[model samples]
Target: MAASPTTGRGRPDSLDHMIRLTSLTRRYGRTTAVHDLTLTVRSGHVTGFLGPNGAGKSTTLRMILGLTAPTSGTVTVDGVRFRDRPRGLRHVGALLDAADVQGGRGAEAHLRALARSNGIPRSRVDATLREVGLAGVARRRVGGFSLGMRQRLGIAAALLGDPPVVLFDEPFNGLDPEGVRWVRGLFRELAGQGRTVFVSSHLMSEMEHCVDRLVVIGRGRLLADQSLAEFAATSGGSTVSVRTPQEGALTARLTAEGGVVRAEDDGTVTVTGLSAARVGDLAAAHRIPVHELVTRTPSLEQAFMALTATSVEHRAGEVAR
Candidate 1:
């Protein structure tokens, strides 16, 4: 599917590479996997999909790929349903599961099969392997490849058609540190080329660095969808860490002064609804000698946990070490 400049192959067309989900819902018997989801994933940005377990992420992705039917509502790629489009791979490339590939086939053979089915150029297969750093292992059977190698091969297949829209579920699962950095750069480069890139992963730190936008869901419902910065800013958890020998006294003093204090396992107290300066002042006024006082901005993981805390399907108890 080498896109001709005039026919708009490499870049998006008049619709500008948008995935629109309107009241998109899916149900299994009495259980609803997705509830009235409505959002637009636009081109030129890497959108991260996030949720706790059983948030209907896999079901939603399947519905978008036309592999599963929604109970109600609709999902459209570039203003048209995915199933309605002939040769859909040229419009949307996805990696739902890297392990779904045939293990008996060579890496090149697997990609060739995909290319043939999608009407993608046979020659593009080799080029994609080289692009994904799999050229050296093109003829290697997928069964012999490591998890990291399998991930690269799967990425190569997704880029085989050079589609305008791509979705990846946990693309960094088996990547090394170097591979992780490469994938992050790849997402940015694709977004720079005006493609709609939607990725779903539980790695909050990776998402913080990779995605420009975030779409968070919990309990089959939309929890947050906005720019990464905007979502982080909304966490509303500006906290100060206070470490002192008299932790109990300091915590009591901070709480008495209308501050929320959460004890840490490290013998420190995290003070909220107050500033570092106020925490220091309270410690001094209460005659508590402070060892450390530092303000901390909430990370993406912290923000995600805060939003999905109530929505977790099965909360695990702390394991004693």
Candidate 2:
């Protein structure tokens, strides 16, 4: 039986290792787009590269692909620099900008040209187009393609070489809900096959569902590098919700026990710094009738906001009057 198109053939040797960045820095005149950033994108996991606008996400990606020169340090994939590799596309496939393609040629023709340049087979062009759901319009001129179609074309180009390491910068920008879900599943499938998938997006909600690891940066500097679960746990612990007829007593007891308690409009109390078991035990001891009790973990959006509060480049109402 043939392997599914979604699942590339067995993991290639070229993707057996990780991508390493050592003291990577890029400066453009007086502005530093990327600071001394040392990080690793491990294989078999989907890593989300997150940062605010002007936070250097694109610059870092460009440097990784060897499209832009770094001012200092180095970025290496599988023990070889991208620019130094004889066939770089075979090792690393990236979708940096959707609009970077030739507008005059058809989608299939454009991808065939790229495949030819990178020593990829001609048949892979149509295969990738089908994989990206662009086979129906493969012969249409790219000049009239919508932003979403262009994005799919870019992703097709990235997969043309069947590279082990894939990088996508804001790939979900112009996609609809179905497209978003498809891309999400595609990333997971790619990573499941022991490939390194690094995606950059400003949508915390999207990354929360798709990414296993996160690499957050601000002002060109690395801020947090951790798994999604670790980030949520360390930034702010879970909050316990409690509802009782004796709100005053529960609040007082929780507050006295060093738990930050806030009463909600619906007569429920939100307590932090205390576990649900502890709250229930306390209520039992104090004879407080509990109607509802639940623990809620902080959402990824909340955690990201808390983590990047200090790293934001633009703040609302900061303009001069």
What digit string (tens of lDDT, one per residue) describes model 1 on residues 1-321? Answer: 111112113555533789999999999999999999999999999999999989999999999999999999999999889999788878898988888888999999999898888898988887888777787888999999888888888888778888999999999999998889888988998898899999999989999999999999998999999998788768646788888998878878888999999989998888889999988887887789999999887799998998898899977895756
Question: What TM-score do all the candidates reach, one by one?
Answer: 0.83, 0.95
Model 2, C-alpha of 166: deviation from truth (Å):
0.2
Candidate 2's TM-score reads 0.95
Model 1, which residues run further than 4 Å from truth?
1-15, 240-271, 274-295, 318-321
Best by lDDT: 2
| Model 2 misplacement above 4 A | 1-8
How well is each residue in 1-321 modelled by candidate 2, as lDDT tens digits?
111255344576754668899999999999999999999999999999988888999999998888899999999988888999877777888899999888999999999888888998887887788888888888999999999999999988888888899999989989888888889988998898889999998888899989999998999999899999998877656899999999998899999999999888987889999999999999999999999999998888888778788889888879776
User: In order, what lDDT does every prediction score?
Assistant: 0.87, 0.88
